[model samples]
Target: MLVLVICLIIFMTFVMEVGSIAFKLTGVEPSNARFQALSALTGTGFTTKDADIITKSKTRKKIAMILMVIGHIGLTVIVVFAVNLPQLISSWQLIIGTILCIVTYLFARNRVFVDKLDNQIESQLVKKLHFKKEPIEEVLLINDEYKVAEVRLETECSLINKSLASLHLTSKGILVLAVKGEDRVILTPKGKDIIRKGDTLTVYGKIKNIEEILCK
Candidate 1:
């Protein structure tokens, strides 16, 4: 549900960008149907070829952003798994390496085993990629689970390029644990530090409430 909502919001943002292109570049009036608006905006060489973004450089650039976002979200699962699998396996390096010859043969010869193992890897990969429920250490130290989680962000919310305080999550029961950005990961953020994009915020709070605020 959380992933679906985030993807849907991203989709809607793309659709709106398409609508803007349709109005400005294609000279076609915007419509209530976002799907149609996207088709029109992309100028996917539909029947209305004149309206297609290929003819308009600016619209084409905007379309590129949509494509890039789509590529990122769609391929994230496969790419993340491929990149992280070695790291996870390396954690058991000594034992695994000792039995590498047998394991390699077993993994390669049986289709069923290979498929099942890949599925397991994919499942674990997605679970790790989900940023909603953080680990215990990443959360604030509170006496009880009932306590509201508050993360005081020194940097901006990387995705939205805004300050931590502007996220307006304290009212929603979320706490900031750490601010991690370029060069360093600060366990506790100071007021003046600027939160930039690509920073991983370690946050804590009631799992459900925190998920609702951050994932949404």
Candidate 2:
């Protein structure tokens, strides 16, 4: 029973990681993607707006479905094993489980380890799934004062053909983190980088300022 419990925990962790990466590949922000993946897996905390994001994307919807199914089965098994724990309780098993749990927790908390694992899993998923790599604009509220978002430039956008230096976005307290062109991504885009139509810009700033400048 103890072994089964440990196995289930590991499986669920892997599944959640996969789900998070899958959501990200579908264009969801990293933090939001992880939150949504956890919500779907545990069958909780699905706000109407958040749930709509999942339901609207076919790829995300499929990933959510898989996570939900696996989560239900895994949780059910865990419950059954938990109920039978008293009958099989042993001091040695308890000690071992505790030690294993601590080790797992430490490994998970290690940023380097987590990054390596995430990269490997993401690589495997990309190879197997061949997820569509379209540029998508996603806006997320960070707090009462700040916001972070991806704004896609359109043909009619006023910012098109203008360079970042000319727009003076930084003067308005807006920072452009990256510019996603059709073929590649430019991190920390320079002042000379021009905004082209269909390019996606990841920006961060105060809520009102971002809305005024980029939301249009």
Candidate 3:
């Protein structure tokens, strides 16, 4: 029972990690992706407006479904094992489980190990799933007042054909981090660069300011 419980815990950790990676590949931020993955796996009701990110994306929805299913089954098995734990209590089993749990925790906490494992898993997932490697428009909230977001310009938008210098985005307290054009990306785009339709702009500023200046 002890061994089964320990193995289940480790398996749950792995599933969470995989879920995080899957969310990330679908353009979710790293920290939020991990949190959402864990929340879904544990059946925790940690909903926020960000939950819409998963619901709106078909890939993310599928990933969440898988995590929830596996989480339910895994939790059920763990509960069954835990119920029998008192009856089958043995000093050796307890000691071994403790050592194994500690080892697993250490392994999970090791940055180098986790990074390598994540990289390998990410690579395989991308290859098998044909996930897009390009940058996707992801918005990240820095705090209550500020946010970083990617705004994609449309053909009919007034911003198109305008140069960054003419727009004076700096005066508006908005910083353009990068400009992803149809063919390539420009990091720290120069003021002279023209805004073309279908171009994605990564910008940072106050949440309200960003919405007013770019999202419109």
Best by TM-score: 2
TM-score of 2: 0.68
Which residue pairs in model 3 clash with each other? none
Candidate numbers sorted by lDDT from highest down: 3, 2, 1
Task: Tell me the lDDT of model 3 at 132.
Answer: 54
User: Mind giving the per-residue lDDT tens digits that candidate 2 earns over 1-216?
Assistant: 786698798889889998998887777766688898889899998999998789877888999999999999999999899899999978888888888889889999999999999888888888887875433534676888987778666576788899999999999999999998878799979999989887788998886786677655
Q: Which residue pairs does candidate 1 place in steric collision?
A: 43-52, 149-174, 149-175, 150-175, 150-176, 151-175, 151-176, 155-194, 155-195, 156-195
RMSD vs true structure, all candidates: 21.6, 9.5, 9.6
- Note the clash tally of each candidate: 10, 0, 0
Which of candidates 2 and 3 is the stronger one according to TM-score?
2
For each candidate in the order shown, give its overall lDDT on alpha carbons: 0.47, 0.83, 0.84
Better-scoring candidate (lDDT), 1 or 3: 3
Residue 150 of model 1: what lDDT?
31
- For all predicted structures, in order, the TM-scores are 0.29, 0.68, 0.67
Clashing pairs in 2: none
- Per-residue accuracy of model 1 over 79-130 as CA lDDT, tens digit each: 5545564445544554544465455556658899856754554354346643
Reference-based lDDT, residue 49, model 2:
92
